[model samples]
Target: MEKRWLPLYGNNLEAHSTIENRSLTDLLNDTTAKYSDNTAITFYGKTWTYKELQKFSEALAASLNGDQFKKGDRLAIMLPNCPHYLFSLFGTFRAGGVVVQVNPMYVARELEYILNDSEATHIVILSDLYPLFKSVRDKVPTKKAIVVALKPGAEIELEANDCLFESYLKQATAPAPAITIEAENDLAVLQYTGGTTGVSKGVMLTHLNLVSNTEQTYDFMFSGEVSPPPNARIVNVLPLFHIFSLTCCNFVTIRHGGNQILIPRFDMPEVLETIKKEKPFQLGGVPTMYVGFNQVGKYKEFGLDLVESYVSGGSSLPVEALEAFERGTDRKLCEGYGLSEAAPVTHFNPSFQERKAGSVGIPLPNTDAKVVVETDAGWEEVAVGEVGEMIIKGPQVMKGYWRKPEETERTLRDGWLFTGDLAKMDEQGYFYIVDRKKDMILASGYNVYPREIEEVLYQHEGVQEVIVLGIPDPYRGETVKAYITPKPNSTLTSQEIIEFSRKQLAAYKVPKAIEFREELPKSAVGKLLKRKLRDEELAKVEAEQSS
Candidate 1:
């Protein structure tokens, strides 16, 4: 309820009482008009100027409309990071259609649910992934599909209902249809959260929500700079379908009229070489990417000093990685926090001010947060430094979960969003996430947070990566178990990890079980999949009990 971070907010940064309540295309159009000749995108060795990118988007939009895809319709876009992603996104907005972001990694079963649930009538998919969609095509309601092969001539079977992406664009060189947009009410993107805890639901993000978030992210990142320097280049390797990459990388690059250098995937050597060649002023990615940067240990050699700002989101950046990055590059890797429900960014460490290593920093401009715990009576705001669920209220917050009124009601209370994340705020307003509310382990009636144990385990030399979770225990109700990936060439054992953890953690807090693996499960953006590992362990326990 109080603005504890206000006193610390500086660098000429002031909150905007009202951001532009306009469609995302308004942002795209203004940038295109202002910087028509600017190089908008660079994919491999090819580049697209603003004029060319806009013309392509217009052509795609006209063709989609000509093909009977009308306003208010949903068009799924499933592609990796490339120029095609930008075209599909802006084209959907101009065509008055809602964009449904589908992960390129999704299989038939996972893909079918989103296609059916969102009632998407069309999809723009990758040629490589076309057969996967074809496998489940008859089961879904999609009428048309546009398959894109970045490198043409890769054989892909196409029915009469499907067309090649270039062919689809060439069919209509007509101007974009003039479609009126109700920015506040009209849907922009149906961003689906990873179905870790349960079924993934489509988050209804209106044009106003996304545009507002883009503005907020820009202001927070640049410290209220009017515009980035001329010809600024942004090197992005994060997946395009991810909201974090969409807003922070794609949207921000548009706002700045900067050059976006794209990499198809996270090939560490390529990323480093691109940074050196392109001389981008900023770099952003998940914790794992930062870890890879540290592992490669080529910050100075790769000319990382050219990049002045480094951002980490999608998941928490391990403190160890953060420290290692600073030691390697002599620069801070600022970590922030957000969720799909809030256009994915609400707080980031202040770029020009004191940054706490573990905290997710304070709320962004025009946003507010409180750490509140639910009591037997009702929800109550927790005292400073006390652990509780974090609640947020901001213009970036999603309108609601699509078609799921009950879920929408449960997650959005009054004007605040119940994030379902356990956290605490210091007196200075910096927030430290304890863990997910559902991830607390009860060992001998004592609450054990997996993140707390995981952080301690990270200090061990042999442990490369670790995930901790609660397992059913006969006497303790639930015991803590850890799944770990040991460093290459390390002679680490389960007993050694247990003995190491015992020294740093209380006896009850120590992991009762340890399982070693070559690697841990990760999401599309490389966030560790704790729930997936927990589910597998639970399934094994169920089988043991039955036997």
Candidate 2:
């Protein structure tokens, strides 16, 4: 079969390629050795050189090894996008321990599930989040809690097994202990999902999986453009715990020996100020951040033209948001698609080529993707422009779900990782995500993808945010329903929204019911939580019927 994306490859990209087999720590070591004095990371007003980052990570790694943390031991990291997060991430890898990424915004219950599931022995967290951990510490198997102060001179009341992050690093001045790591087989990081579909499971990404994905992203982003190694400064506003941010911002920058400006969280003012002051050449963000930046109406004043490349991931970029962002900032916002199972990136819009609006561009080099329809026999590849599950085969694919062989077998079969995302490919090989397989609505025996309706709804002037879901209908098996958050102070009614959607979508796909909302629930990284809206609507219906 001919790959349609070959002609769309960047000038420097090949139709197929191979990546080096190396551990994440090896990439850090190589960069630190080559760019010792170069700035590696910038947070707020402070900076850490490659040498400094390497030294600090090594120090922490020594401490972990000294504390009898062996290879394959899970070390949970629950800090935000701080310098401490990097230290802990690399330190765990250097100590031959698997790093389990924990969302800093998780409550005690969510935190307990991840810790207990991964069986993490140690955790590095921020002082502000100490209470959440404290509430669930006894329920998990965590042996030590290393706390980092978010503010300077902030004191933390440590428990018996707790230690300050700085103190832990200070205990090991010697070089990191040597440990052999099998890059292909050894687990490097266990990334947890948001559990939108079901219970969150650990995504076990091996060292090779992460390293390959980083290289794949680097090749696509830097191909035929400005090289890295002190020339590129990538502004990272996404949370470090998310795989999209982890691969693109943290590892990709480290791979190129480029500087990363880290923001603790997405504060529009802080992000704009940092971009204006720092003058970063590249920025990675989600669609919501792009929408927020477009709404700021201050890009021209701040001279945001310095940003040459803007990459969007985590969720499908609404066409309205993309156009507004490009028109507002005079920069192209390339939309990409990835999931936690594929080391987070399988497809990205080529930076140097014609970026198709509403498409997630082509698969990365050496990655093969095909849309397949499930058949009684097994699975059959679908034709172009036909919707099906997007299955990908690449080195970046995860080994499997952590410790869940049955689930792993179900997801990974025949060397293809079955992405639960429903997508369609055009003749040019660009893929447009239709929706999640589980999120597809069956109404009147016709399939309706919520994303199609949501995209049309987003184009409405009064619609600020909208989530389309399926509700149980008495006539049709399911009916389309839209929950819309209107623009502030805009008296947008359900009739206006339904009328607007009717013009763009098919009669069957048009929302049967439109409900106005003040705000929509979003994930920590700002992706709209359609599952929450679905659950709430279902519960309300059940209550109404019962009453």
Candidate 3:
């Protein structure tokens, strides 16, 4: 099969097509050496230069090296988008330890499962989240917990064995000890994600995987443009634990010697103020963030015009949201596509080229992508414009899922990572995601994509947010059902919504049932939780049957 995306590469972008054999530590070291005095990160009000970031991370690494931490040990970081999170991340890597990214919003049960599964020996978490760890401390294998205080001089009472983050960093005022790293083989980070199957699994990303991804993303973003334009600034509001932010915000900023304005969480007022004050060149977020900005009414007053690039990921960007955002900001929101398996990025809408409205764009340089139909014998490549499972072969792909050989084998086959996303490639090689394979609804032998239905619902003036799923039906195998939240002051009824959808969608694809709700469930990163909704609907059906 011919690679249609190859000929579409932007000028000078082909140079980065091949994966560079480098480690993330090396990339950081090189960036710090080149941009020593340049501001690397800004949190709240304080800023850390590239030199300072490296020095502090090295110091912390030295301290961890002297402690129970060692090479190959998994060190879990459960902090938010603060300096402590960055310190813990690079420090763990510098100390030859595998950094396990833990979501700060996880409850005790979720934390315990991840900690026990990863077998992490140490954890760096916020002071306020200490109780969540304490509740599950006895059940997990974590040996030490270091608490990072949110404010300066904030006193936190710790258990006998625990230590303060500042006190721990003070252990070494000198440089970190020398360590050898196998970039390609040695795991650098264990990022947990619920892949298509909705089961949380640790994706083992090596130093090379992250390094390659950082380079690929940097190249894809700035192709044909000057590298590290003086004083580049990227707004960082997405959670650092998310792979999208980890690769794009943290690593990509460092790779280009850019300034990162970190926000702990998404507060619309604070985000607007930060944008106005910092005047960042790049803004990265999911679809929901853009929707929020579009609805803020005063978003233009916040100086969004300063943003040169708008990158969206973590889920498909709705066309309605994209159009609204572009209209509001007069800037195109480039929607990329990735999964947790590919170090989280494989394709992005090239900044230097024409961006298709509903497409995830062509594959990144050096990345080979194909849509394949699963056959009885094996996987077969589908024809152009045919919908199938999208698989990618790239250096950015993870080594495998940690301690899950069977699952890893099922996911990664013959050097290709089988992304369980249903997508179609156009004649020009632009990829448009149809929907999740699991989320596709089967009604009367017709394949109905929930996104198609959701897109139509989003066009409704009264619809604020919507999620479409399949519900079990006696007549049909599965019936399309839509859960919707009406806009404020809207008198939207189920019948009206059904009628509107009927006008846009086919009878089988039209939502058979409509359930109005005040709000729908979303993840920490604001991704619609269709799985949760589907599970709720299934439970209801089971309950009704049992009763």
Candidate 4:
């Protein structure tokens, strides 16, 4: 009988002593062994069974002549969510290559930089994105072979120079290699993150880092419970390039043996249509997704009748958005906090327990979390319920940032990953996020978390999207400003939005001014690029203040 990991007294219980220890690659083998006939991936009416996925993955590995690349050689994969994406990902791992995950939406400049920086010798991209790569492929030093995936939802146009993915599968006949992979501390993924600070850098996650985090999230959700029906379906819309979706939707779903319905894009109507058809048991989304879904007042159109859980991450879930969703679907939205550096997920609200509306829940099982104060005397753990830098030390913490030893040392100290996020833990162990250290808005000697202001703006019916930022204010040092994108066809004025927000937000927390745009700029992974918006807003504010 397979040993089951159970929660002890609502806390995480250690099972390292009971189970057969294995690496991530080994875990994949076990999944294939148990769920060979089960459906592993479903997209656009196409389903790949676990057996078929395993076979194709091994075949692709064999065909790659993977021995050519060293054990930790990086293979950059730039493609959207598709069957080939999965095959290439697994195949690269099976071939003993580190998967350098790249967002498909990246422009030439971004793509070229990552390619050159990582020294990625081979790249697998989508057909449509190939043209963009061709623009800068010559400038990148490490790119040698460019393998393009056939564009789905269109007629096959196999160029003479381009090798069809199907042809490679035909050439691969050998089984996957059986190797004792150095998985514990070896780099498995290089996920890139960018912000106002600097250029994008790869977040190095090890096999144990990813596996531990996935298992932690899975355990928190109580996946594979006894009383509840075991077979469940999860709606996955966030891009897999993002750590949040990659860990929760893709990796954890595999462990839970849950069916994942992948939607390449988050189109409101299409998502609702799919939901009505599939009646998924769980839905995972960011704040933007939840807000958009709530705006689709035709909530009845979505078959939310069967949904048992809804998880939110990437950003804070607004109270109004959660309430609206709950009112319409009767499903509570559980919000959590994590970053790309920590294998994406560290803490989450217990799926079966009482969920606090504004809090981001407690730490994961087996993970130690503490708020530490930083001073000249060095770092010291702060008392409970005190706001400070949140630090985590566990198997889930990444090995370090790739190639940047200085950064790795700075981030990882004394077995603890010093996350730059600000938070406080309550008496009950529930953690509440204060804000991002870099995102703190200094207004007249006061520090404000933009999420607090944004939450108030989200309560307005006409507000479609809102991003609060700090603008240079000579008078007060800094002033709270808002950039809003209202609902389509809605004639909400900036003054009206400001007035409505003023009613709810504190005087200092309220926006001194507001600007309305058609849409807010977002990262390729669907995260709101507040830094970009802030830079633009700061320039505009500086110009106005100078005049």
Worst 10 residues of 4 by lDDT: 1-10
Which pairs clash in the backbone of model 4?
A: none
Tens digit of per-residue lDDT, candidate 3, span 1-547: 7888876784557834556677777888999889899998898789999898888788789988878678999999998899888888888889999999887766665688889999999999999989878888989999799899897777677885789988898877556778899999999999886533435689999999998888788888887443446869888988888888999888999988899999998888899998998888888987667777877856569988667789988766668778878887887779898877898888888767788999999888668899999899889999998999999998999999999999999998999998888999988889998866666565543446677677778999999999988887643457788999999999999899888876665466678889999989999999989889888877998999899
Instruction: Please give me the total number of clashing residue pairs in predicted model 4.
Output: 0
* 1 against 4, candidate with superior TM-score: 1
TM-score, per-candidate, Cα-based: 0.81, 0.81, 0.81, 0.77
For 1-547, candidate 4 gives per-residue lDDT tens digits of 0111123223433433122345566666787787777777878777878778777777767766533555777888887667777787777777777888887766565678789888886677777776776777779755444455555455445433445566665665565466556667678789886433434668888887788888777767663231113446677887777788888888877776666778877777788888888788778887767777766676666677457777888766666667877888776678887888889777777656667777887677667788888889999877777899999877778877777888889889999998888888776777788766767565543446677677768889898998888876543446788899988889998788778865654455668888888889999998898889877866887788699
lDDT of 1 by residue, 1-547 (tens): 6789987776457866358878988988899899999999999889999888888888889998887878999999989888988899999898999999987866666688889998899899999988878888899998788998998668878986699988899887566679999999999999986323335689999998888888888887887332368767888888887888888888988888989898878888889999988888777787767777777896888988658778888756667778888888887778899888999889989876788999999888899999998889889998999999999999999999999888899899988999888999998989998777567665543446677678879999999999888887643556789999999999998899989876666576789899999999999999999879878877998999799
- Candidate 3 displacement at residue 371 in angstroms: 0.4
Give per-residue CA lDDT, model 2, range 346-450, as digits (tens): 998887788899899999988999999989988998888999999999999999988788888989999999888889999989899887766766564344667
Model 1 residue runs over 4 Å out of place are 194-197, 224-227, 439-547
Error of 2 at 127 (Å): 0.6
Misplaced by over 4 Å in model 2 are 194-197, 229-231, 440-547
**lDDT against the true structure, each candidate:** 0.84, 0.84, 0.83, 0.72
Candidate 4 whole-model C-alpha lDDT, 0 to 1: 0.72
